[model samples]
Target: MLEPEMVAFVERTKSLYPSDRAVSTVVEQRAMYERLAAAFTPPLPDGVRTHDAPFTSPDGHTFMLRLYAPFERERSSGTVLYFHGGGFVVGSLASHDLITARIAADTGLCVIAVDYRLAPEHPAPAAHDDCLAVTRAALDGRLPFGPLPASLQLAGDSAGATLAASVAMRLRDEGVKGVRGLALVYPMLGVEPQSPARETEADAPMLTLADVRRYSALYWGDQAGNEADGADSGMRASVSARVAWTIPLEASRYDGLPPTLAIGVEHDPLRDDARLFAERIRAAGGQAHAPVGKGLVHGSWRALATSPGVQWMHGEVCRFLSDRAAE
Candidate 1:
């Protein structure tokens, strides 16, 4: 059951999104997202300490890193290196402000939300490079995650999760294994060119396949020299002999990964994406979280402060993270 707050949350959503229905499009989609984001306000409290600092990428594009830690840091745990999901185009740390703050409070860890360079301006390796760079910096010196657990959990929803995967792969490639865990939320794992399922879910609420197409164009470009294909389309290159940017799919390729938990929403376009990856992790001999968020939707975890579904979903997330920390 949704918390009582969820009722009001749904009502407010109805008022804000007249015909909250997604439509088809390949252009002008970014403007549509900007409109939706402008109207959406997450109701969270104040007094949470946050710092907006700039970090440099290997390619030299500057990223704005927002650190959200508890006001009372005397009792902090570890840290969550998060990437904001906007399909590599639209979102930033500011857009996910309340979500990051709540993660800090809920998971008992400082959440570092990275504002990676977006597409149409900076593409491919630019975004992935920033995520990798920051992860190294946090584990190296800048962040206050003193000798963090052998593994720092990398997390994010949608595009952010994709970046997190990239970071994990890079770390593995460089023979680094400091990541404690990974939490992925309905990650976009492939280059959805003309997949039948993608075409079918073209009108998912809040995020449409059409919107993804436009964002893909902006990120990967037209494919005819516009996109940094290898960097943007992570599926194009294998991170290892078996797994690429994702955990695994062939069931036999899931070795050497740290503990992992993947959360999926029933009413999301990316539902199967999470399920397939978790299955791969389990097949590879790593632990995978239970059934993906039952009866929930994409973006539910981030909606914890306002929506009922979000509270339930995040409760499960907290439980999963707590269990991992205990292990």
Candidate 2:
């Protein structure tokens, strides 16, 4: 059952993004999503300041990175590399500004939000590669921002969470160290046929299961079948080993990941992704904390101001970052 505030949050969200409206093109989808993001984005928290800087990836692609720093902080405990969620197609640095700003202010850490390339224009591996490059640069203190605190962490939501997890795994494989923690919020890890939430919460408010399949197709450029077929395609299978970059669940091993906090909202189809991911990490002898937001739905991060469940989730994230940064 949904809380009254979450119920209102769902209603407000539906008004901004009506299910009845047909958004046929990627442009339409992106525009609508941006409008929604703007509607819910409040002013930055009182003690946080943000600035944008240009970053050139290893492949010579230049993009923006927004840095959020808390006011009057002598030294940040660590830096967080954040990725925003719009199923890899629509979200931008502006869309997730408030969330990152609050994290910076609440945890006294520097938060850098990546403006990675979107899908249908720059498909799978493009966003993943950009995020990986940025994380590597941050870890090596090679980003233009100059010397950062030695401690670093990866954080993201939805598709962005998938990128964060994959980057953590890849870095582990390369034996690179220094990532202290990971925070994933309602991550879309993969399309597993038997995942219970995929069936039970298929039509959950905000993000339906069909929406998940459509985004997966657009991100992977998988047109082998209709959007309803989800991510199960010949091309996806052909590159399963490499596909882990886009779908973290495809990774063969979950060992050696940093301490992780994977938040799964109860009413979200992707809820099981977080749960299963934590289970896999623990099975491999790593530490992971998977918490279910009792009455929340997908994308409830936008409701941090009004919803108690969202507030609790945010608190959990802050504690995770603070603890890991202190270590």
Candidate 3:
């Protein structure tokens, strides 16, 4: 059952980008997604400012990073590296501006949003690689901006949340330090046909199960081998191999990861992903907070202005950042 506000949010969103529309080209999809993003984006919070800078990965691919900071914040408050969600295909830094700005303003922490390369042009591991590079640079104080504070947290939504989780795991494997927390909002951590939400919410508004499969195919491309469609054992093995980084749930272990906040929307097919992830982390003796946004749907973070559930979720995220970053 949808809350009244969430229902309105979904209706307004579909008006801009119809969920039942036939398949379209990537460019067309992006155009529609941008319009949807723009319609929901609120004015930037007072005293929060943003600027963009170019970041070149070790492999020589250049992308942009948008930094949001409060006008009178202490550097000791730490930083958050944010990634935007568009299923690895349709989102940009500009598209997530309002969310990032609000995080910066509310948390009093600088937020850096990565503009990683999209898929179908730079598929699997490309976006992962770019995010990893940015994290590394931030840890080393090598970003164009001034030195990062001692506290650092990695955060993202949807596909971007997948990248953030992957990067956090990779850093743990590398014995790297400085990351203080992990925050994910409606993350698509993995695809399991029998997952509860996948079954009950297959046709979930805003992001359907079909949409999940299609975007994943585009992101994994041919590199996913026979499991590209996620029906074969070959895909599982691939996930165990190079593809694991792009799919955090595929990682063999969940121990030693930072304290985490994984927010799941009740109406999203990906809802169980967040819950399962937190359970695994806790099972491995790590601290994790999994909160389900009742009556909310995927991409509802953009509905902060209209949805009370979104407002509550945003406050939870801000508290997580403030507490964990200070730890």
Candidate 4:
């Protein structure tokens, strides 16, 4: 059963975006996604300062990097590379500014949120390449931060979490070390259509099976040379071929991944993605814990201000990062 507040929130969302009309075109869909993200994002917290900077990927693709710094009394706790969630098709620094700011304030860490290139226009490998390049730069102390600490962590929500996990896998594959932890919030690991959660939560609020297919198609369709709708073109085949690292859940080896906290919602279609990933990490002899929120739906993080459960989850994430930093 969904919480009353969550149920109301879902109803409001449905009202805002009625299912009667089809959202045509990439522009229309992207606009709807941005509006949804902005609607749920709360005001920026006090004591948190944010500024934008320019970052260039290894492939010469330049993008904006939003830095959220909290006023720490002593020294900074650590640095976190935050990737905003929008299913790789939509999302911006503004969309996730509040969450990033909260992370910085709660963790006392300098948070650099990457505004990676979106897909369908930019396509696959574009977003992943940019994320990987930025992650590499952050790990190498080449980012705006002057000095590095041993407590660097990676974090993201939904599709962003997929990217975070992928980057961790890539870094591990390359023998790059010093990544202390990963914080994944309701991640979408591009699971097969027949997955149990897909069948069980077919009508889950915020994200349904149709929404999943639509978003996946938009990001991985054209790149795979499929003329059909992004969803019609089996995403797994195209996405896996374009960038195998993007599919962290199916990665051949997960032995070297750092301690990870995978948080998911009870009714989310992607809940299995988080749980199975954590299980895989543990099976590989790594530390990975997944906590599923009771009666919550997908994208509950958006209710950070209004939902006590979400607020508590935020604190848990901060605590996880801090504890890993101390290790």
Q: List the residue pairs that clash in candidate 1.
A: 151-179, 151-180, 152-180
List model 4 lDDT by residue over 1-327, tens digit each.
Answer: 887777877787776655632466767866776777777767778888777889987778899998787655237768889998988887899888778988888878888999999977876667878989998898777886456454689999998998899989989999999889999998987634336888999888788888777777767664434444546446756555676677686678879999999998888888888888989899989999999887788877877777767877898899998887776
Candidates, ranked, TM-score: 3, 2, 4, 1
Model 2, residue pairs in steric clash: none
Whole-model Cα lDDT per candidate? Answer: 0.63, 0.87, 0.88, 0.80
- Model 2 CA RMSD to the hidden true structure, in angstroms: 3.2
Q: Which candidate leads the pack in lDDT?
A: 3
Could you tell me the TM-score of candidate 4?
A: 0.90
TM-score against native, each model: 0.77, 0.93, 0.94, 0.90
* Candidate 3 CA-lDDT value: 0.88
- Give the Å error, residue 171, model 1: 1.1
Clashes of 1: 3
lDDT of 4 at 216: 77
For model 4, the superposed segments whose C-alpha errors exceed 4 Å read 18-22, 148-150, 191-194, 222-242
Candidate 1 local lDDT, 240-274, one digit each (tens): 32223322232235566667676766555666667
Q: Cα miss at 289, model 3 (Å)?
A: 1.1
Greater TM-score among 1 and 4 belongs to 4
120-155 in candidate 2: lDDT tens per residue?
Answer: 898777888999999999988888776677799999
Q: In candidate 3, which residue ranges exceed 4 Å CA deviation?
A: 20-22, 73-76, 225-240
Rank order by lDDT, top first? Answer: 3, 2, 4, 1
